[model samples]
Target chain A: MALFSSLTPVFIAIICVLIGVILKKTNGEKEKRETKSKPLSRPWVDEDLKDGTDHHLEEEDVDEEWQGLDENVAHVPFFAERYSEGEMIKRSQMFYELLNKRRSVRFLSDEPVPREVIDNVIRTAGTSPSGAHTEPWTFVVVQDPYLKHKIREIVEEEEEINYKKRMGDRWVNDLKRLRTNWIKEYLDTAPYLILIFKQVYGWLPNGKKKTHYYNEISVSIACGILLAALQNAGLYTVTSTPLNCGPQLRVLLQRPANEKLLLLLPVGYPKKEATVPALTRKPLEDIMVVM
Target chain B: MALFSSLTPVFIAIICVLIGVILKKTNGEKEKRETKSKPLSRPWVDEDLKDGTDHHLEEEDVDEEWQGLDENVAHVPFFAERYSEGEMIKRSQMFYELLNKRRSVRFLSDEPVPREVIDNVIRTAGTSPSGAHTEPWTFVVVQDPYLKHKIREIVEEEEEINYKKRMGDRWVNDLKRLRTNWIKEYLDTAPYLILIFKQVYGWLPNGKKKTHYYNEISVSIACGILLAALQNAGLYTVTSTPLNCGPQLRVLLQRPANEKLLLLLPVGYPKKEATVPALTRKPLEDIMVVM
Candidate 1:
């Protein structure tokens, strides 16, 4: 009994040491999580990470089927239209004049646009070049009034949250100047609501994932062509990226998991009362540096 | 001396406990750092962060000069050209057919292109919409042979490293199929190289940074318009994004720190022997979902 008492202090010290170790471990994990959860302060580092072209490293291996075809695909002769310098200058000027007239019209007319024009515009968009020719865009055209209203609901709900909470005062102020708010009346008023989706990854025939490299950039480029096509057809749309509403809109549109909403365009003619902000583009000298 | 001997075991035990606590603290810090350094495994989280539209939260407040304009800009009546339905369909179809012929031609001829055409196309691109109408694109046209060669050198060096080290086997294989390698002969051979940079943020009059929201996507959309204008003017270019070479190229070009290279296009006529991958685009039904 005397020996037991003597050893008690040593035993107690051992238990104390173990308790300290356990507490340290728990605190370490908690601190680690806190560090990660904190918004990254280094913008440059985050910007580098968001390069968007590093999907090859981010994804698993795709199937050999399509890739093998890439190896064997024949290279065909490409012949482009050749025009004289005068003709080239004239065509470019005319095209520029045509495109310059395009404005993001918010007050859309409910007049029905020919469906053929929408299809043709989308087809033109599909011709856009992609990373390694991986066409990773899907255009969802909603003409039904009910579905458009539902989309408006999803978009407005999220946008309201964005305006009320997520968006700062400057952003709200900027939007206010643009005459834009969370309430998007054009969603229902436009004849068609084109929701563009970028497939981040594709599922292979074997159920494996195929990474779409530079998909966002590629899809945005396609949208640019789509805008041009719409202009050519005398159509107008206000390009919108509904913040924090991608997942809900994707599910509402019945799109698959790999698809992500990139841009939403309400396509139609502008109402007679439609007005746009009197904006001027920067002169060529301001935007271009010739070396 | 007798009392000191009796307390020796207890003192040793107390020292051991102190050592344990110190060791645990050190280990905890090391583990916390390790957790922070690990590549984030959650993609959806990363994807959310990559939403280019979230710059308002990411940047500091800008001086209120231009933003003030956004608030008070006059809403003028926007009059658009209204075409008959048949003419609209025809125009849209014609535009599609024209864009459909556009291919990513790798073998570009050294034929000099009209500078006026390039200017007009850039003007057209400037007309494209942006987030809060902040035109965040810089089109750097390199006509000097020496500078183009320097750009090519920088691109090739980084590309070689990417091919060998950063890119995995599958990516290498994918590019192999596309017949693209680190040796970018077109950079030197093409008459002009248009390097597109997205000004991540603009400098306000007060020297504070003005955040360009959705800069990457907006610049890309402008690029789309640029591509359309190029096609209209009978110019050919292969859109290329030189990975890991943006910083070096930016330094060589003497662009400001705010500008980051988004895409580099080698612009000219296609080589008579220019061949593109014999690829077919998915049909309209495949790409478009109509509701």
Candidate 2:
């Protein structure tokens, strides 16, 4: 009890210090000019930060009844204005509903999904944030019979090797429920294959290979978005990272040396006789803690 | 046209070849005694190699039957006999809806989020799939006042330094849209601060650190699940890396050195008057391509 009481003051001091520190880091850079006053008022009070007028969300609030205010962030455009209150709620809710229906489709139907819809869904994925905003990802849509065949050939070859030599007995044992094997009929059966690539670093306009910030994290987030958007757009997706096709896929796609193959997707409708593994989700109590 | 027509047969042959190879590998290890076919008559012929069992998810059936004939998968315990149609639709739809609302929130409200809620969410995050099933993340929940303050201070100091010195002009300029400065008040205003540590590897059952499989990717996916769950539970969150609090956080928390700070999250209810930056999503056409 005594030890705990003594540590109380130190703890309080730490919390105050942290709060001050974060405000300084997140706000200080924005108000470099005002060293004398609190940075908070400078941006929040400035009419410009309330989303000064440039956006395409179809909202009608940009007409200025007032005059000139300083643009606090010269580089950053005003937070995308033009989104209305009702629209925001609607869009947010709609997105949630759409995302709810997504599934990993292992069994696929031969029914064709429209290319335009797929393209639109992908467009949504591309909007995700990336390291340095490099947006370093390539979406390859494979529909050609020969190309998919080659991909299947490559993937199956590697999988067979992994099952036999690379993976241990324990791993093979662990995979007993996944129902996966080298024969990926979906690779050919699906109407489309979206191969994703991640670029570690990127080429600049001046021919320099600029370093990317948090490349792996950025790519992972974007990949998640891509998967989600496909589901939202009424498509089934399974994220597959084949063990040994890194070299073969790179060469086959004629991709740049800096880019690496991350996943192979067979996107389409589920077969009439499709079924998913009867997996039970952990109850909210097991998964969540409410304070 | 003639070249394309001739290639179709070649493609079909290639798929067959892949199938042959995969079957060869799978059967190579199957025990001879187990290779005998079942004599019982069934409607489903099941032409393909049965890599795993299917507890059929029939829409007509309300309860999913567990036959208990299959192998085990982490976080999946059902050896289901049959899945109901409603179950499949519910699962698929749930995935879709949850996925769409998923967003990385940087802007946050200071209103306190319950510790129990955060804990529950972290537990849920733990349910995600890990590479080789080696769970490689540690969750450190810090609610102590002084510790929170200290974290804020250190984070701000590093961020300020990053903006002024390390980050180039272009990089800083690019971040302009975010209007992010070093000040992170949400760290304090929020009720709970959850620090996620990525364990590179940990001691095995025998006291040796075991090798982790694609540990980074696995942990990230878990984070994704946690984020989804938190949102579903009606809580707001802000994900941050802050600046240089990584080492300090580990020290402050007295964690094993193998763990490195991955993300610092401030969870709570959105402030009553709080507003998120208005951002626009890219149109659907820009992202997807179906060949």
Candidate 3:
């Protein structure tokens, strides 16, 4: 018994050392996980911004079968309205001139835009292509002054944190030339605040979650079309991705859990004194490779 | 010395267990990193794709100062063209009608399109707004039949693997209704195959890597504008992300390592017998909510 008690001290010391090593390893693992989830390079990106695979991973225990169309749908013949080459050239050049005039105007006028125009442009965005025709987008058009202010508060609050704390010196320095800070007066001044939400997943008729593949890319493409529509209609807005404000905005708008905010555009006419950074686009040769 | 010898066996046993635990933890860490890098739910997404953070991680030892515009650029007064309310409504409706007519046409005609139109449409795409004014996009207009055919071969080979093996039964079954298969004859049939690449990062004048934030979303938006320009000029094309063909096509087209293929568009006239699935967009009310 005396010998065993003598050995207990050494055994306890070894156990203590082993436990310490294990504790350090576990702490390292947790730090690694945190870093993995929040990439250091792009700290401004919201944690909620993902490609819906996270949701899919959670629901993996449920239905493994894809609940898309049960049977093949019929295809109808498509006849395009073909324009003459000369006409095509003219139209293309004219369209380019019109769109080339587009600038991301941060200062918006409170002038009431035609609600019909906003409706038409949102409708135009709805026509964008999706992965397997899964149209996973929701357009929340907030015109109520109270809701607009609420959104502005949420955006400015998060953006202040982004600029001051989350976004490091490099990102802040990168945007120094653009003169963009957390102040978004346009959010309150614009006639409409069009907040776009990408539906990560949709419910099947049987109450199962159906994965919407490429939802972010799909919705962004649709937003592209929406931008064109807005420009074509002579509307002005800035395409802003509010950092870290997605979940709050999603909840503020009462959007379902499956929906995440992708973009927020305050649509209206530019304030008469609106100014944009004198930025030049890369020439066609610089941007295009003809091979 | 006699007592130490007696305890040696127990010490060795404890050491063995400690070593085993360490090995298991390390293995677990490696497995976790692998899973994090390649999310299982969206396995078909190319592994190369990332928001420029991977490159940033690699270059951590380099200069950390952002090499964007050193001096703040001047802001210029912006004046948008104002259209009458009636004109605005009419324009918005007309634009929607034109864009709504667009369908993803897989079957393309080999008829030569006006290269000027292609240039202008791309120019319009170039005018897209990007993060921090970093126009990170390359539109490779491939008209050469040989190169086009080479692209077709690469796409088809990858697509065959994707459809046959890479994509499991659920994905394949999901796409069964769309009638899409590994066969992509449009790669050869289209007069021009516009491969859009997002420049993930760019080299500064001082040879340091400049991060291009939101490059994927920016390029996709440019593509949206490109699609709109094509439609306005009565051109027909389909928006396709040829799965798993990004790296090969990038090398095939001689693009730089910093660029990754985002979308592949076959632009030309549609085949006479081009048929589209009778898909209807969600109505404005279904897609939009007013608050």
Task: Give candidate 2's TM-score.
Answer: 0.58
Q: Mind giving the per-residue lDDT tens digits that candidate 1 earns over B42-122?
A: 211222223232343345334433444346788899999999999999999999999998988889989888899889988
Better of 2 and 3 by lDDT: 3
Candidate maximizing DockQ: 3
User: Which stretches in model 1 have alpha-carbon errors above 4 Å?
Assistant: A1-69, B1-70
CAPRI level of candidate 3: medium
Deviation (Å) of A195 in candidate 1: 0.4
Winner by DockQ between candidate 3 and candidate 2 = 3
Report the error of model 3 at residue A255, Å: 0.4
How displaced is residue B90 in candidate 3, in Å? 0.6
lDDT of 2 by residue, B87-204 (tens): 4344445544444443445555554544545555665566554544456677677777788888888888878877776554555655555566778887777667777766654454
- Native contacts retained, all candidates in order: 0.69, 0.09, 0.71
TM-score: model 2, chain A: 0.67
* Candidate achieving the largest TM-score: 3
Clashing pairs in 1: none
RMSD of 2: 26.5
TM-score of chain B of 3: 0.90
Cα lDDT, all candidates: 0.81, 0.54, 0.85
Give me the TM-scores for chain A across all models, comma-separated: 0.83, 0.67, 0.92
